[model samples]
Target: MTSQSGLTRRLSDADEIVPDSEYVSESELRHGSDQVVRETSRSLHDNDTDAIMQMFTEKEFETSDLLEICGPFLLSDTAYNVMYMSPGIINMIPDTSGAASLPVTSLFHPDDRPILTETLSAQTHDGSIMARLKLKDCSYAWSNITIRQGNKNIHRALYISNTDELYRSYITQKKSIATLEQKAADLTRQLEAVNKELEAFSYSVSHDMRAPIRIINGYAHILETDYCADMGEECRRLFDIILTNTGQMNQMIEAVLGLSRISQKELFITDTDMPALVKAVTDEQLSAVDNSDKINIETGNIISTRCDSVLIKCVWKHLISNALKFTAQEATPHITIGSERKGDKVVYYIKDNGIGFDMQYAEKLFGIFQRLHKRTAYPGQGAGLATVKRIVMKHGGNIWAEAGTGMGATFYFSLPVTDQ
Candidate 1:
């Protein structure tokens, strides 16, 4: 009932036409048809085109003229039977002659057929969906299909645009990210194995060295006790030096064994009352030494945290003992122990007015057997701070110090806040 000119005007007035740059040439479409059958075999006659136009007129919809200017598109009934297909869409079909009877689902990729079937069965289909459509060459291209419903849902028009290039690029990037993640995991495992082997080697060497050191110390003690009175003063003094050097060596070996044990120990994490722990360490240190009256120790508010009790206790013992030993020379010795909130972590510090070393040597303070002062002056194997650093790091924390020559020192450590 609709005139040919009227249908052309209606389609030209429609707003969703594909740009001219996107339109497929008739020659290109014929090239695809040549691989199957001649283009004339699939072409519609003048009256045939008029009858398809009349079908749209009865439904009060006009869309056939759009087939010339739009991108690959198709019209289908609720039953998914192809009513009309554009030349560009015909180029995508391997056999255009059989297109009219072909089910629309056959054009979609196998993995995407279920999605198209679901949309056709929906009460209404008016939005857009993305799907992979099968091409004439048997390959698939990503497409954006915009669905437009006609009056009374007699038919639906699908405007499809190709996005194959972009989809392939995204797939390539995803595979690259997965490969990088796998490489990182492999490197982490290798590092862990190397660290375990080093820890075992150190433990074995320390364990074996203890016996020889013990023998030397025992023999030297015996010679001093039985032969000191008969020997000259210089000989006795030299013998005393041997005993002293052997004692220091034994202590260093013990420190190494202790360090290895801490590395291998399993953590027993718990909610610890930090204030009580600090108080207990301070009390025990003061009780063991007779200088409690000379030293002024102050403790401020320390928040609770979750940590391993035994390991953390060792940390407190080392830090507190170091503070006491360094501040012993001060006429008015003072020590402060407290903690404060720093963002999402709690920073605890021990301040002492002691004989601090230069700030330039701070990096060496936590290395085993590394000392800034003479052994006779400090009377330590320089393992206390190293042990403290290991314990703090095991708890997922960090330790650092600030000091100047002859000035006071402050050691701070941070622990994440696990409780409100």
Candidate 2:
């Protein structure tokens, strides 16, 4: 578009940006505050007074606006003048470097000064003169120095820049991060110790008690069969009762074993074929005396899991068996086993249409030897769920039950994604 004359210019290509060297001064330049950069740059050249004024020069120096944002500033007029000074300028003045200069050097620990001097000198030589210095008061600090070329410039003329506040804040932040990391590590160690203890305790209960129980059952059977006729009727009846006690004791012992092993044994993690394990557990239950026709098993998606196959199958058996046993009087017991992916975890659920417990008893359900029903009503030592609890805990997972009295029970367990 043209101005007053109504002449028009067509737009072609977009303008490109280049560094200062390529945009060299040509004819005449402007300090045209009224004009846009593109218009001004097109006219700028060496002859322009405004352009010379804008050029940075060695004689004048000032702290950069950037430096002000990072920290506080202390400036001598000399430092102010030399800020934009060309590199390699030394600013030291022997007298302004501060009193007791030689004496201050003497105060440095004999072993420390050489290392400090070498390091400070190296920094100066390499174009960076910021240094952390230890003061006479035992407080340490950081200071930035600009060395400008001058007749009076020497180490003695130097005055240090104070940065204790910024340094202190940096140190504090570093220390806080270190403290949190250490606390996290300590907590991890404590948790690991507690878990080890729980595992050991579970193992001891399972392996140690089962043997004595088996012995008691064995001897009771031998006495009943071998000494029946030789014994009086009263004695025979007592033996028979002992035999019954042994049988119940065996059931209790096995329950305890199941619970303990579930919690204690190290898991043999493998990629399990879920359909196969479910079928195996179901077949085992069918083999149990008088159970097949009484129960109907409902199956769903049997997802594969990286888990202890044997122990997991045992968990299934105990839950299913419990469902069947509790609903022994029901015309037909219905049991459902299924799985789903919940976020990064696999959730497996077992639901049973049986003598479900009151919801208030849920917390006590997984506790060893804790039972809601009487011994004769639902005969169990209440070890099965406890075993389930341990197994879940071992996998860095959790188990819980949802139920209402006589409405049926559902147990759900979760395994972490890592196990998948």
Candidate achieving the largest TM-score: 1
For candidate 2, write residues 155-212 as lDDT tens digits: 2223233334434665687689899999999999998898788667656665776677
Q: Give the TM-score of candidate 2.
A: 0.51
Give lDDT for model 1: 0.76
Task: Give the TM-score of each candidate.
Answer: 0.66, 0.51
Give candidate 2 misplaced runs (Cα > 4 Å): 1-264, 289-291
Shift of residue 218 alpha carbon in model 1, Å: 4.6
Error of 1 at 332 (Å): 2.3
Range of the 10 consecutive residues with the lowest summed lDDT in candidate 1: 1-10
The TM-score between candidate 1 and the true structure equals: 0.66
Error of 2 at 294 (Å): 5.3
